[model samples]
Target: MTDAQEPRRARELGIVVGSLPTGPHNALTDVPGVRVGHTTVADPPRLHTGVTAIVPDALGPGRRSLPCGLFVGNGFGKLVGATQLAELGAIETPVLLTATLSAFRAADALVTHVLAGPGHEATRTLNPVVGETNDGLLSDVRARPVTEAHVFAALDGATGGPVAEGCVGAGTGTTALGFKGGIGTASRLVEGWTVGVLVQSNFSGTLTVRGVPIPADDAAPVPEGNSCMIVLATDAPLDARQLGRVARRAVFAMARVGSDFAGGSGDYALAFGVPGGAGDTPPPDDAALDPVFRATMDAVEEALLNSLFTATTTVGHRGTAVAVPHERVLRRLREAGAIPR
Candidate 1:
């Protein structure tokens, strides 16, 4: 598997996904205490998959659980530890993303890492929230090259700032909207609170960016059995129910980019927040949440575009998903007046 060649994000091409201004890094890591890490596996003949770790809030020592929620757009896919997450409405471990078949192993490895962290001596139960998308179209799903070490490596290597996207980590061999799909992330500041999103895009649908339709390419092959995993983070002090509301909006963003939400596709979104604790400012009421919702929809949509734009052509055993040509998309957006000349 050749490395993603000449990756570039949408904004680099003068294309903005929405009207809202982006956070400093325009990434999920823009959320306070959020960190991301990736390990791309490209071991020839087979194995073009890896792990991506997102620690919502630095979890170690005596850190408290972060409020979290889950919204299922489709239930035809595998997501480890969904029930417990929905039941508890909080998470104490880092969120992990990996290929479909590798999810359980990744979850186990995550549990191990959390158990071994600085503050878990007598902790009996630990829930590892893991998400996945089918990448077998490009990689040998049977091999399951991802190991516990890879999980730990991703967890231990987490860092803040700009996140590495496109054909990297769990997105190594994913396909989306008739193009090579991979890890993508973006963030937006709404009213003062920041909402950030990261996506592992491997679903099927027509591609559209900023109201401009991206014509299908004959050279690219469509993938079978769809799925997409979205992770959203914010510093807003939101509870599980509120997070679920925003999570649904993220699916709208996905639809805006062209996902059909087919029966076979398991579309899942997990949202978490680390609100200012104690005497810190309280989160806004529901009446004041409209701006946050809008920002979420915008960030998610832009993040999907960023996924396509930053990824390069991927050639695999099953088929090849040529990267979407940025010049062509830029032209369409220019024609549609989505991008100013």
Candidate 2:
């Protein structure tokens, strides 16, 4: 495929987000022990949805729940198990993402997966975290095409390293910022610690790239979309409380990418930290969080951009959602001096 005909990440086009150096994969899996997998369900003119799973290291033998935090940028989502995560400040199972109507099933599958894993034979109580974005505009939401098997496939196939992005998994039928949106990921190394972010971009607003706005005609008719889901992982040896604060920064980064956080947008960010990370000796002071916060924001912004850049056009039940016109966007950025001509 030609350049315009193919999909690529923001970094591939020289649209780096911040000054921090990225990990080897420049993705959420760069945090180590974090794996991602997707199960795309594309059945032509009617179905275009799937499942994305984020599995932390605490899911196998000697499995131990990890410290986690949930930050809600907007309260318009049907996020299952949020109350428990908020009250308990941790996650017992792998986090899953899927279409709006399929969130419940995905959560159920997650619970089943955890209960069936080694060491959880007799466990009764479990909280399965699942987040979703409405894909009704592009798919038959009422049909609920995503099934337990699909969720299981995602969970079972997850692996660490580079993750697939855009027009896949839960983002298959999603749109954002007036363009086709999907899965995106990015990571940053802060003082030898890794902070990684993965986003399901479906929320809308003005389409901006490095502070330059694409002309409205090519940026869709209006800033219209419903939700976005952000998943952040880090190996900083932080607890749930600190992760919550860092997660707030991740949500704030949505604004940097032009998210309006509209009334209908269900914007949520879930952050988790591995136990035996660098700084396990003595937790760093809150005063030293400035760099971590900055890194989180920057990674989120780039992840959102990657969601748009790597997505290709799609035609579904509702209508056609075109991918961002990368060449045109780059032209705008160049003229505005965001990139060299």
Best-fitting candidate, scored by lDDT: 2
Candidate 2 local lDDT, 274-328, one digit each (tens) = 7574235566788888999999999999999999899988877777778888889
lDDT of 2 at 72: 94
Please give the distance, in angstroms, between residue 226's alpha carbon in candidate 1 and its true position after superposition: 1.3
* Tens-digit lDDT string for candidate 1 (87-158): 988777889999888999998999888888777988998888899998998898878889999998898898
Decoy 2 TM-score against native: 0.96
Q: What's the CA error at residue 182 for candidate 1, in Å?
A: 0.4
Off by over 4 Å in 2: 1-4, 215-225, 277-280
Task: List where candidate 1 sits over 4 angstroms from the true fold.
Answer: 1-5, 277-282
Candidate topping TM-score = 2
Model 2 score (lDDT):
0.87
